[model samples]
Target: MTEASREVGVVLRRRPVDNPWIDHLWSPAMILDEVPATAPWTVLSTQADATIYYAGPASIELFSSDTANYRDNLADGEPRIWVALRRQDGGSELELTKVTVDPTEGEAMFESGCDVIGTVPMPPEIAAWIAAFVDEFHVERVFHKRKRDRAPGDRRGIPDEGKRRT
Candidate 1:
């Protein structure tokens, strides 16, 4: 467990949905502080609404540049860990793609339209771990707004406005 990275086990839930095109929906169910002896993709449990499977292990990577995002997450009343699962080609199996504590990186994962991305409550153990990293690496950035350089008369990018050039 180094300062820059931490490994955690993830379990995913496959809930049956009413949608005719899909059989089930995949989402991160929970994160485990301890790596379970259970095999990846092995069914852990089944309930009326969903079935849980071990989605294997993932690493939460921290960067000194990203400490601000981590701090914001810690300040959030309900801190969450972002999890992403990628499909195993055109099949039902899901691969645990990424796990992250930084909110900015987490939201960026959603830009990939094909992956199953979701957030799970940040485990207390993991939250403390991230908080420790932030305390050590967080650097306060002073925002310095820069004035745009432009000719005073130039209001638009167009060379000439309101008149057509014949």
Candidate 2:
């Protein structure tokens, strides 16, 4: 993919907790090829790989939350950063092919054995490219509120029998 069309960001991780005095918890390590840098992401401790990038000082659009997946991830107690990647050849449409955080989603990409080159700050050009992709693809979804049902009220008392019947 051309540099102008590529969506990029930095994948970061914390220094393993083996040292006594760690200056910084997180450090950028690799460039993400597919995920769009939309909003200013907070530094998180992803048990897997985490990403942080300059989302340009523009408004970010978001989609509907995957509640089930979110709950499952929370229940699993292993935090992760979800990275989605797409590939387009020549003039063909962009096809989503990988997600590093999801094993099943990016099985093929994982099997390819990609390596991390090194850490670097998010480049301005790459940030702009990701911003463009986010502007084009990210859609604003309305949050739907669910109504709660009222429980039925039952107020009845049973009389105790004085003697047992034969």
Candidate 3:
């Protein structure tokens, strides 16, 4: 981590929704716990209490996995940024669940109770931030390719050399 990099926490707010059609649904919203104090980053938009601010040069890390769903975006082309928010047992602690560039993996997290609060587009500033981190840390990983096992050629075991046939 560089002196210019700061860990900006994502805070999630959950409010109950009472709908006749849906049994239980909670609307999730996100806001930065604190705005990053850096250059080239400014508050672009603000809704109610959530503020969408432009991020300056920073560092971010993606989760590591062998699943294709996690690597497809990185392999295909430029990856998209998805910020996941999750709360446990209706707790107050808002967790920044996962920061991923893979759509499939992000969807899976959403389905598993992690609300995708925002999908940040890779603007030049954001892209450069991610690029710096990736350049320093992201390494090309070789996937393990599974080979098909050979079928059992003979069902019966080799007969004992001296055993008599029944």
Candidate 4:
């Protein structure tokens, strides 16, 4: 199946936490529709409590099969783009893994063992892009109810020794 992709930049925040076990908390802060010229993992801002970093460019992929989910997402008052970050083995603390507009796929990311996953408000431009794709390729699927069996049947259709059907 043909798919659409958009290149965008992801911003992450590292915040000093009060927890005893962990030193800092990392999360996706926002997404830039246009990838900035700065290098990946570059620190953009630093504050007393939190620091923002450009996690680098990630692609938001769109499949025609998933346009239904995307449409549902846009219907919500606050559209969101889900970002997922994983902990690197030894190179970097965190790596930008995925950015998606499909809500079902986004929800599935929570089940992943990634270090950080979050939803950021969908930028107007990105939302419009998705809307246009959905409008062009979305196909409505009609649901049909299946008829139930007339009566309960034997397990595996096995014939009983005492009562066998001719």
Candidate 5:
């Protein structure tokens, strides 16, 4: 099957954790609420929401087009940034979380599990600010609830831990 056919109507899954590396990435985003009104995106299917950090440097990009309305057919209605998360296991089911681009706050809130994780996807120009935020603020510790397994096939066996052992 082609790449498009491989990703038909699929969603990623997410869990919560207090010591998420993403805390650094999303915090500054919240300060300015720098939500991209319009841009293209490349979805990196990973194991759970917390694993987003593993997507590596510059893994997060602007969404240039609507990604097949992955947000419960709400992509067209007040579009927001969407990320896919899945379990560590190679399951076929996942969760779709939306973060509203707060033009005022400079960050996006993870609406699904707002209490757990908030992410900020910003342009590269703001890289320096993001760095300072990390250096200035002490990373808070958090605990996230484990998500139940959905239908199989949503996960792609992507390791969330720092290293990928064979």
Candidate 6:
């Protein structure tokens, strides 16, 4: 693999929730462990001021196939785990992607498209600092993703040719 295409491991713990939408998208039981709240400097240095939707420590380290077995059991259509890494420079570039579930080695189960969840640029030092702080563990749980709901009415103002009022 080229230097830019290299892979690093990371874990994403879903944030706690009261919103039905957010709650449906993830399962908290899958978390490997609760990071101690006292390590602010470590947490701050790594995560920085990144925008994470979930309430907990957002990104973590990726381990073995069985590490995220909980994600495998999750029902279809939930928002899968996504990780974004800032480029060495100031650009907000997403370097890697994976599902929260563990896949068998050599098996191509997870596929991530290029959708950036955030816009801020993260420095390498900050990214590296965060990378060092996460701990890895094995666990699984069924997570959910909120389905899209339709708006109150049709947005199209102009009627079809046959339906014109005149």
RMSD of each: 5.4, 15.1, 8.3, 4.6, 24.2, 19.6
Worst 10 residues of 1 by lDDT: 153-162
TM-score-best of 2 and 6: 2
* Candidate 5, 61-109: lDDT as tens digits: 2121322222222223433333333323444322233332222221334
- Output the number of the TM-score-best candidate: 4
Candidate models: Cα lDDT each: 0.86, 0.37, 0.48, 0.91, 0.31, 0.32
**Best by lDDT, which number?**
4
lDDT of 3 by residue, 1-166 (tens): 2322434433333333467754332232332333455443245555654554343332334443323443455544655556765565676444455655557765676577673356544434544554455555555767899976657875355676788988
Our model 4 lands, by Cα RMSD against the true structure, at: 4.6
Q: What does candidate 2's lDDT look like per residue over 1-166, in tens digits? A: 1212234454445444556664334434445444554544444344543334332222212222323332333344443333332334533222222322222332444445432112233344444544454455445558899965555653234345585656
Q: Estimate TM-scores for all models.
A: 0.85, 0.27, 0.43, 0.87, 0.19, 0.19
TM-score of 1: 0.85
Instruction: Answer with 1 or 2, whichever has the higher TM-score.
Output: 1
lDDT of 1: 0.86
Candidate 3 vs candidate 6, lDDT winner: 3
Error of 4 at 158 (Å): 19
lDDT of 4: 0.91
Error of 3 at 98 (Å): 2.9
> lDDT score of model 3?
0.48
TM-score of 4: 0.87
- For residues 37-77, could you state the per-residue lDDT of candidate 1 as single tens digits? 88888899999999999888888888888888988998998
Q: Is candidate 4 or candidate 6 better by TM-score?
A: 4
* lDDT (tens digit, per residue) of candidate 6 on 1-166: 1111122223322344568544422212222233444322222222332322222344333443343332342322342333332233444322333323323321332233333222122334433333332223333447899866667875565466666575
Residue 40 CA displacement from its true place in model 6, Å? 25
Q: Give the C-alpha lDDT of model 2.
A: 0.37
